[model samples]
Target: MESIYDEIEIEDFTFDPVLQIFQYPCPCGDRFAIALDDLKDGEDIAVCPSCSLMVKVIFEPEDLEEYT
Candidate 1:
């Protein structure tokens, strides 16, 4: 079965007004979630901090999905 991550296309990082959060998939196969209130523009990448992995928070429209 396909995963949710493979069902939808993910676009570049954009501020989600409704959720007020920034969401993106990291290169480490993990999802990186950041609060919009805690982020600043021009910040596209961040360290996982927890796992110490380099994570990119931005992606093209074809990079996201809703896997099950």
Candidate 2:
């Protein structure tokens, strides 16, 4: 299996307007979540809720316009 530090495309994630975060499936059956505020602040890492793993989110600044 690949390391949890691997990077994934933004398209692989789903946005939750309520939580204001982006989430992706994790190999550990958990979900990796990154807050929209954090992303807007230039944070690209999403950590898994059930394990010690994180993936670098692939996105651009313009990707956050909808949330603003």
The best candidate by TM-score is 2
For every candidate in turn, the CA RMSD to the true structure comes to: 10.6, 3.1
**lDDT (Cα) of model 1:** 0.45
As a TM-score, model 2 comes out at 0.87
Worst 10 residues of 1 by lDDT: 1-10
Any runs in candidate 2 off by more than 4 Å, and if so which? 1-4
| Candidate 1 segments whose C-alpha is farther than 4 A from its true place | 1-11, 14-19, 40-50, 55-68
For candidate 2, the per-residue lDDT at 33 reads 96
lDDT of 1 at 54: 44
Write model 1 residue lDDT over 1-68, tens digit each, in one string: 21222222224444466776655555666656655434444444444434544445554433332210
| TM-score, every prediction | 0.36, 0.87
Worst 10 residues of 2 by lDDT: 1-10
| Model 2 agreement with the true structure over 1-68: per-residue lDDT tens digits | 43557798888899998888899988999999999999999988899989989999998999889777
> What value does the lDDT take at residue 51 in candidate 1?
52
